[model samples]
Every structure is written in structure tokens, then in C-alpha cells.
Target chain A: MDGITVLIISNNIVLEKDIEMSADSKEKQLIKKAKMGDENSFESLILGCQGRAYNIALQYLKNEDDALDALQESFIKIFRSLKTFNGDSKFDTWVYRIVVNTCNDMLRKNNSRKNTDSIYWNDGEKEAVLEIPDSSNAPEDLYDKKEKRDHILSCLEKLNPEQKEIIILRDIHGFTYEEISEILNCSIGTVKSRINRSRLRLRETLLEQS
Target chain B: MKCDKTREMLSLYIDKMLDDNLKKEIEEHISTCNLCKKEYDDIMEIVTHLNEVEMVSVPKSFEHRLKNALQHERSKISDSKIIAISDKKKNKLRMLTSIAAIFAVGLISVGLYQDIIGGVTDQLDGTAQLAQDQVMQERVMNNETESDLYNSKLYKSNLDEAIDEKQKFEIKLDVADDVQSSDALKPRMSIYGYTDDNSEPGSTKALVPENYVDNPSVDGDSDGYSKDYSTMMTSEEFSRALTIQAIERNVAAVQFYKGLIEDNLRDFNYEILESDFVQAGECRFRIYIFNSKEGYVFNEEIIAIGKDGEIEFIYTNEFMGL
Candidate 1:
């Protein structure tokens, strides 16, 4: 497997470059090679997808350490199950599914251990920290936007596990309904219904908060 | 088109799931119907707000940590394999030494026994009888101990089995467990029971298990119950109950697959060998079509329970055209 070593210049620069080449054909090619037992190709694929995978794990698990553990476990699973990838869904969607499963497993384990203190951030904490895009609004509107974003996260927390997953994938990750359906191993009709219901619940949650 | 029908399709329209023709119909209806248009606008606003929500980035060290962990796992696996190989070699050597020592001991014992023959055999027989009695007593005691141990194990296992069975029964009845509240629980329909009851209504009471008596209303026909009891469940309630069962079955299928994979305990990955697509089973689902009275539009939640008792959900936009 052909591997590319990306030199970390700076955070902002790396983030920009990652966004630019995020959907490059080379990444898929690397993933294909990695799936065929090429460690180097697998390494490159990991390097490319690691950020997003970690972000997803973080979103689900909340704790930095748990997120890290999930990320590693997810990568190992990806390596083991790479041969099962049929390219029916986007590589990212497949990767995200693995991450989500890993996170869920971790959540179950943590629940069994009664470890509630590790990742219990409410929607307010997430909103206060994360930045939201507001193209039409001025600097004065930034505070209100943040509050709304926080409200949304709080609403997200109230959703059922399945609803949360679908909403996050569709609204946050920007996955298409078809891609989500394939990743979730459900019919397209089921996927749409879940998204629709989840959105309604989210709206209800926000309205209730107001 | 009726305002209610137009309102039901508003979500699909926002989702872009509606066909072009249906979309045009909804658009036309919205133009004339203020209530429908207002509902549509509200849903769109919510969708837009959700879309604008930002995602948090993963920590910078996340990738590095994953790569390091993978490397560590690989090393550990390789090390264990090497250790196992070396251990096998050591065991073979130890076995050879033990065999040589056993042969040496047997040869020396035989020589000693041959030298002390004659009257010693008679005395040995007398002593052996007494020793045999002692051994028999010991054996009986050992057997008793073993039986006691086995019985204790059986007792504990039986207790566990009882608990599990009771828990499963409660879950089936929508009863609350120790871990969670069950106040808002809904009853689930059973496909096999439904078929059996539908075939013979009077016999439904006999077919139902004793545990199901607590939640007898799960039976769609209510088993020829009074009209008051029948009115307790709305049409939507009937559909929802059915959909829940369907979701349970669906989830059970997946759980069965997971169980098979876990049972093998092999590291081998699954491949799509072959698939036979068929739908032979009866619709074993409780379909909950909410907001049905207002219009034909309904949100259906199907619960499918598989043979293994695992539950899965399948929500559908059955009334998208309404």
C-alpha cells in the first residue's frame, strides 16, 4: 500500500488542507490498498480519517480518553473488517459506522461500571464551546447564535439513541439519506422516517426550552 | 387537496422525499391553505436551524493516540504468539523428562518386589482388604462431597434461571425492571398469538400464556371483551402496537446474526456469500400511525421481535401522499 506522510505544519493549516483534500480519490485508493493488508496504505488512511473519526467518537463518548480509546478500537475494527467493505456506501460513512459502534460499546461498558461522571456534558456546555456558522448575521448576533446552537445540542441530548444518531449524521455530518441508509443497514424509507421524526422531536425540544 | 393531507406531506416536502408530482400538489395546496402553509414554514425553519448547528472537532492528539494504540496491540499479539511457541517447546522437553523418570522408577520397583517374595504375598492380601475398606469409605465421602458441590451449583443456576425467566416475562408484559421506570410502557402484540386467535377467537384465552393476562388488551380483538374495553384503544393505538412487534422481530434478526458471529469467537470477517430474498412470514409488527384522525398522513413505527427476543424499530412515512 502506498502511504503518504503528512507533515503537521499548524492546526489551522492542517485543518484547511484536510478539508480541501478530504474527498480526494487518492484517499479511497489508499483505503483499498490498506484493505488488502498493506500496512502503509492503512496508516495513510488512518492519518486521513483519524480527525473525523476521533471527532465522531468524541461526540458520542464525550471524554477525551474514552474518545481516544474508541478511535483506536474503531481503527482496529476497520482494519479487521476492511475486507468486508463493498464500497456500496461512502468510505467515510462506513468508517463513521464503525466509530459509532465502538462508541456505543464503550457507552454500554461504562454504564455497566456506573461511570457517569466521565462524559455528562449537557447541551449548554457543547454550545458554549463549539462555533456555529452564521453568514448573514453580524458580530452582535454571534452570542445569540451560540445560544441557539446550545439549545439545539440540549435538544439533541433528549433524543433517543437511534434518533440522535440519524440527526447527527444527517444534520451535523451532512451525510446523504442514501449513504445513511446503507451505513445503518436499513431501508431508505426507514431512514427518512427516522430523520423526519427526529427533526420533529428536536423542534419540539427547542420549542419547549423557549 | 384537503389541508390536513397537505400538512402531512410538508415534512416530506422539506426533506425532498416527495415525488415531483406530489411536490407540485403540495405546493398548490399550500398556496391555497394558510394552515398547511404555516405548518410547512414552521417545519422548514426547524430544519434550517438544525442544519446550521456546528459540529465539534475531535482533539488534535486523537489520531496519534489511535496509531499508537494499534501499534501497541500488534506488538502484544506478536509477543504472545512467540511466547506460546516457546512454551510448547518447553512443555515437550518436560514431558520427555517425566517419561524417562517414570520408566526408571518402575524398573527399580520391580527388582525390589521380586527379591521379597513368598510369605509376604499372604500378609499383603490381609492388609489389602483393610485398605480396600478405607478406600471405599473415602470414595463414598468423595462422592457425597461431589454431589453436594453439584447440587449447590444447580441451586444457584436454578435461581439465576428463574430470575432471567421472570425478567424476560416482565419485559414481554411491559413491566418495569429494577433498572428502569415502566410507567409509560406500551403493550406489544404477538404475531403467532394473533394468527392463532384470528383462526379461533374463543380459544384465544387458552392460547395466551398466564403471564399475558396482566396485559390482555394487547390482543387486537380483545378476545371478545366488552365494548368499553375496545374503546380504550384508538385505531392509532392498534397500529402502533403492531408496528412495535414488527420492530422487535427486525431487531431480533440482527441480534441473531450478532450472536452467531460472537459464538464462533473467530477473528474471521463476514462476506456476502449469498442471499435469498423472501417475505414468507406474516406481518408480525405493531404499526403506530400517529396523527391519523386529522388526515391520512401518519408516522408509522414498526417493532419487530425476532425468535431470540431482540427488538428493532422500523419507522415509515406511510402517509407521505396524504
Candidate 2:
């Protein structure tokens, strides 16, 4: 049993290393082929990141139909714009930014603009700028995790588009702040501040709802 | 640090984004600060809840529809690029023809065009035409008797076919690549055919010639020339005029011209035949017919280096008795 466990673990590490290197080299080859007007390589390249991109769009556009529509629109854009992809950064980061930008554009055009009210407090004034209705449940009373999980998605909807994207990228996608910064085309400092504000706002929303 | 300031950085502390010293400072401040601690706990709960939120599942119908749309989109893109390349090629040919027309106009202005029209028919009187295969064969491996075997009607059809199949200009059959210094490339004769950059679909690109420049970069004005190829002037004057316009002015050698030629002109060996002024139509040409076969066999080509250094016309023919 011990020998088998060690073999499996060692195999996993090697496999993981292969996956990382393979994914990178594969992407480079795919980008080159796709740029030269190879639709097969282009299809494979887009499909590689298709799942995450669709999920990101889903997080932004809530409706299942809209999410798929947004994803299709982004792919069309990426198809047309493949030649302009100079390969300055990871293909995934570039794709993420495109998907995110497309989602934002859709949001703007739909004008289903969520009120991005950021709360602030002063020592003299006894209020959060954006008020949260009081809740009886304490912050620690989140043990019924599944129910709270549903509330979080609803709360995510309430946060502004920027805040929601940062939260989704960080908490759900579990991307590092640096990765988030690169994908968002912003500094790590901006990513940090945005996530902090977003988390606080989301926490306030969750507390009031519960 | 103040409670508010520490609270601002509380999330970074959780994310391990804060430097250790700053993190320690925040931890210590929050240790004494209950309100900041409570705020920190609340934010932590939010993050925890979010992490548990299941990844939005992609609907099956959506996935199917997207793939279908993508297939259509992919084909559309490929078709457009293929179209773009072909369109660019057609444009390139038109551009070359325009340059040739301008060169012809220049010849006309100098009274050379009238002389060319008068003398061309008389120059090749008995040899009215030859079949394309017979012509190609005569220039290469075939004997002269093949021309007498074919009728005039067959020759005319063959001529139509040759024109329809993008008429060949200069055909260089180089046996080996011999690299020479870029500076060695002066007034050497060769042809350039503008082509699609994707030589072999997804092959590597040749190192961009730092020294290999084109018309705009070399001499600034490509169309600026003293005179056309065939002139009333002496042969030496004609060569001198070409040498001055193409060589002295530092004209750029053409890059890949699609199906015509590949690789730099500097890589090939060239022999300068005793060139003389000749005319086919209204166009005047410096007929370069060399009997010496350095590598294999060479043919009768009307060579004219444009003022832009572009080998505008490099068509070959097997004149019966050149």
C-alpha cells in the first residue's frame, strides 16, 4: 500500500510538471499556426481556455443564455483579432482579458448597470455611506455553508461589475493577485485594493441578507 | 497604525500579499483593536463563502451552440485571409504592370517607343509564332524541328494558355546556393516575384535582411530613371545608365516574389552577357542573350532593371537565331 501510494504521488508530480510545460509549448505552437490562418490550431487554442472564459462570463452575465452569447461574441472577436495577438503575455491571460472586456461591453450595452455604491465611514459621522440592513446572525454563524454559498452568489451580483470580476477571479477562480493584475491589465496594488473593497462590500451584503 | 488604516490592509494580510513586517505590524495592531478584528472576521467570512460557491456549470445546449458558431467563425476567418492573400497578389501584379506602363510612357516620351514598334516585326520576320510547349522545349532540351511539326492554330491556342497561366518572366535554375556578402550585390541581374509570405504554410521565416531593402528605403524615388531599357545610345551607355540608376543609387533587391523566385539575389552566381538594345512591342528591352552556359542552360531574356531597382520585366524567349 505504501509503495503504491508513493508511486502514485511521484507520478502525479511528474505528470503535473509535464502538463505545465506541455500547456505552454502547445500554446506557443498553436498561436503560431493560428496566426498563419490554420483554423484547426485556432479552434484548439480557443477551446483550451474556453471553459474558464465561459465561467468568467457566466459570473458576469448571470443569465445562462447571456453567458453563452457573451462567450460566442468573445470567440468571434478573438478569431478576428488573432493576428494582432503579438504573444507578449500568456495566451490564457490575453484570452481572459478579452472575455472580461467583452462581458463589460455587454453589461454597458444592456445598461443593466448595478449600483456600484462603495461604503465609507468617518469617526464624526455614524454611518456606512451604503447602508446594510442589520442582521441577527453573527459573522461566525456561517456553518450552514451551502445556504451561505447561495447568498454569496446573490451578493456577488450586488457588487459593481469591477468588484464582482475581481472577486470571481480571486475567490472562485483562485488566481493569484499577480495573475489577476495581469489579466485585468492593472497593477497588483490595484487588484489588492479592489479585492479588499469587494470582500468588505460582499460581507456587508451577506450579513444583511442572512 | 490606526484601526482604519490597518483594516484597509487586513484583506492583503489574509491573502499573504502584505510584506512580513507590515503583516506583523497589522497583526499586532489588530490584536489590540477589536473593531478592526471584527471587520477582518466579517471579510474572512465573505471570502470563505465565496470560495465555496460552486463554479458556474456551462449548460450543454450553450456548449453545443458555441462550438457550432465557432466552426462557422473559424472557416469564415480562413476564407477571408485566403481571399486577402490572393487579393494582395492580384494587386501586386497590377502594381508591377502600372510601373511597366510608366516605364513604357517614359520610353514613349523619349521617341524610343516608335522605333521599337517599327523594328520588332522586321527583327523576327519568318518566326511568326511557336507552340508554348515547343517554345519551352526549344529553350530547354527539345530540338528546333518540333516547331515545324505544330500548326499555327495549335501555336495560337498554346499562346493563349501561356498568357492565361500567368506568363513566365525569368526562370533561374540555380544548382546550388552560394552565399556572398550583401555588398557584393551591385548590378547583378535576377528576377523578383512578389509572393505570399506563408511559403510552406507554417514554415520558419528567413531572417529579415537588415541590408536587403526595397524601393522606398533605397533611392526614395523608385520611378526616377534616366531612360528605359532599350535606348538609341551605345550599349556601354545603356549599361552605364542601368548601373547608375540601379547600382549607384543603391536600389533595393526584391524579396520573395511568390512563385517567381525565393531567397536573396546575392546568393546566386550571375554572368553579364554583352547586352544590346532590343524591343518586343512598344516596350524597349536590353536583350541579354548569352551563349555561355555557366551552370546549365541560359535563355534569351529581355532584362530591364527599373529605376526603383525592381526587375520590372525579365521575360525569356528562344529567338531562332539571336
Candidate 3:
């Protein structure tokens, strides 16, 4: 059993690395073609990046509609202003900047419409206190996983937009601290600090729920 | 290391961001301290769980919408190109029209000057007396007389054949009567004078038509009449009197022509010069004039006619000051 598990783990690691190498090469080629005004290349690039970008927006906005709006705006800006990009950073980092800017703009507009009131997450406490439902031994395990996923999202919502963004990029999106630094235009230390603080808060909330 | 230092390095150590030296020290501390080790394990578990959460799936239509947006942008760029082309065509047409107007003015002025000179020569020869009577009789026979010669189609048409022969005869008779009357009554002070300031006591009243009452200078004295007049007279009366005076005084015709130019040119600064070319079919002298001011500079031509036909000049003024 241990030997089977080890083989599966190694295979999974190799597959993940292959996927990463293929995606990186594909993205670079698409970016080059897009810079030459190839719309198809740009569209493909957007398709590749949309999942991660949408996830980041979803984390910040919580509302599916707002997240979609932010995602659309970010894509439009990325395509329209692609020519101005000097490619000093990775394409993903540049795209992240556009996404972050779009989200910030939406947040500002939302704040103005809400009469500048502070945003607070009332559901976080409730989510932390909510009991996890149990089923039979096997069902209970699956249910627990699902409950934990929901609880994490709820905790993410409780975080301020900045903290939520860092956590999503660093933890959920699997971006390195250096890449996050380029995207956010901050120091690696700052990225590390924010991720650490966000992770600590999320853990505390999870513990409270348990 | 202190607990705070250990705790700080724990997050970095878990993320594998710490250098080897720091990672080694933090790992050594975690091994020795149970409390710190437990905290480190909990943090690691939470980080690992967070990393394991699935990324949200994007909607399928996102690609379609993005493609449509790019296509829409291209269409807008093409539309602006069309607008730019149309604007260029409009500018070309405007330039052509301005050139045509300048040429037409030059031709008309020359025609008037020729007519004026021919009339004066015939009068000097005394052979025109018989022709003048015949012209008067012809004018009475034709029913084509207009109340206001300014609006007469005979005057507007460049073709001499278009003139109503009967109206021409009447004009000849009127001119003959005016010349004789002016010769007989030369004692009265010359009533017409030009002045720079309309407010000057002796300045002639403005010649604006009744339809132009809304004009700023129309109500010069606010006496209900549309324009200021030298003699307190209605526009029609003033126009008739001026016409009669222009016929009586051989020089009055030239003055009337200049008055027309001066009145119209108030809105533009211009210079008038006599052209050496003889007008084709008129007794009036042709003069070239142009608005010389920036933004108003345009080619213009004018014709000045003297009743005895001795005075005539034709000139053309280009858009530039000349």
C-alpha cells in the first residue's frame, strides 16, 4: 500500500511540473503573438489566465456579478493596452496588475455608492460557529471536506480586500512571494508579511469553528 | 532565538522562502520547543489546506465576450476613418467655392465699368439723345418694370439680352430728366456726405432693409425706423432719393457703388484698388478689393460707374493684402 501511494505521489508531481512547463511556454508564445496584434493569441491568453483572474476577483468582491465585472474590465484593459507593455515582468504579473487595478476601481465606485461606509463581514463569525454536518464514515469525510472549503471561503470574505487578495494569490492561486511582489509592486518582505498575517487569521478562524 | 523571532521565521520556513541558515536555526528551535513546534505544525496544516482549495471556474462565455469587444473596437476605428475622409472632402469643396466667388466678382465689376464708360461717350457725342428717347418709348411699351431696380432680374443677369427693352427705355428717360434737373438746380448744398462715425450729425442714415430691424445698428436714433438716415425718411424713400441723386450728379453713381461696398465691408477690413482691365459689357469701372485682415482675407471685385461714363476702373484683390 505504501509503495502504491509513493508511486502515485511521484507521478502526480511529475505531471504537475509538466503542466507548468507547457503552460509557461504556451503563455510566452501567445504573449508574443498578441504583441504582434493577433487577436486569436490574445483570446487564448485570456482563456488561459481567466480561471486564476476570476478566482482573485471572486475573493475580493464576494458577489459573483461584481467579480465578473472586474474580470471583464481587467481583460479589456489587458488587451487594449498590451502594446504599451515593455515585458519587464512576466506576463502573468502584468496581467495581475491590471486585475488588481480593476478591482480597486470597482471597490472605490462601490464605496462611493454606499456613502463611504466601512465594509465589514458579518457572516464570518456565523460561519466560524456553524456546526459541520456528519454522515456515515465515508460520507462524513467527504462532507467534512466540503464544509471546510465553505468555511475557508467564509473566512476569506471576513478579511479586508488587501489581505484577501494576498491570500488568494499566495495560497489559492499558488503564486510565489517574488511574483506577488511584482504584481502588487511591493517588496517581497511585504508580500511575505501580508500572507503570513492572512494565513494566521484564517487559521484562528478555522480553529474557532472546530 | 527568542519566541518572536522563532515565530516570524516559522511562516517563511513553511513557505520555503527562508535562506538555509535561517531555516536551519528555526528548524532546530522547533525541534527543541514543543509549544513552538505545535504552533508551527498548525500553521503548516492551515497553509496546506488553503493551498488545496480549488480555484473557482470562470464562466464559459468570457472568451466570446472578449472576442466581440475586440471586434467592436476595430469597427470603431474604421468608422472614424470614414469620418475623416468626409471632413477632407468638405474642406476641399469650401475652398473651391471661395475661389469661384472671387472670379465672379472680378467679372461683374469689369462689366459694370464698361457699361458706364460707353454710356458717357454716347452722351458726349450728342448722338445718344435720339437713342435715349427711343429707349424711353421702348421702356414704356414693355410691362417688365420692377418697383425696385435692386431686385430686378434685368440687373442681376450678366446677359445684356435678358434686360427688358421697355424697362431700359424708362430708365433712360428717368436718367435724362435727372441730368437736366440737376444742371438747372445746382444751388442747393450737396446734401450727401460720408462720415466715419454714424453718430455724426451729417452722416447718411444706414441703408438696412426693414427685415434687418434686429440688427444692432438698425435703431440708430430709436425713432422706430430701422436705420439712421441723414434726412428723416423711410427706407424706400431714402433708396428712391439716393437713386435719383445718383442719376442727377454724374459722380453720384460712383459714390453709390462705393457706399454699397463700404456698408457691406464694415464687418471686414479691406482695401479697394482700380483694375486696368476694361469691363466687357458695362459702363461701370471695375475695382479689385480684398478683406485684408487675418481670418477675413478673401478675394473680392467691385464695379464703380459714373453717370457721364467718364469714370471707370477694374481691379482684382487677391486674398493676401495687395
Question: What does fnat come to for each candidate?
Answer: 0.28, 0.55, 0.43
The digit string of per-residue lDDT tens for model 1 on B69-90 reads 7788668757876875565456
Q: How well does candidate 2 reproduce the true complex, by DockQ?
A: 0.27
Model 3 ranges off by over 4 Å: A1-29, A112-143, A207-210, B80-322
For candidate 2, write residues B230-298 as lDDT tens digits.
234433454465555433212112221221221112212333433322222122235443322211123
lDDT of 3 by residue, A28-105 (tens): 777778867687898887776788888888777767788888988888777656654544577777787788778877
Interface Cα root-mean-square deviation for all models? 13.4, 17.3, 16.5
DockQ for candidate 1, please give it.
0.11
Model 2, position A176, has a per-residue lDDT of: 89
**How many residue pairs clash in model 1?**
30
DockQ of each: 0.11, 0.27, 0.19
Candidate 1, residues A31-85, lDDT tens digits: the string is 6677555778888776766776776676676578888888878888776566545
Candidate 1 positional error at B165, Å = 79
**TM-score, A chain, model 1:** 0.70
The candidate, 1 or 2, that scores higher on TM-score is 2
- Candidate 1 stretches greater than 4 Å from native: A1-29, A111-143, B2-8, B80-265, B269-322
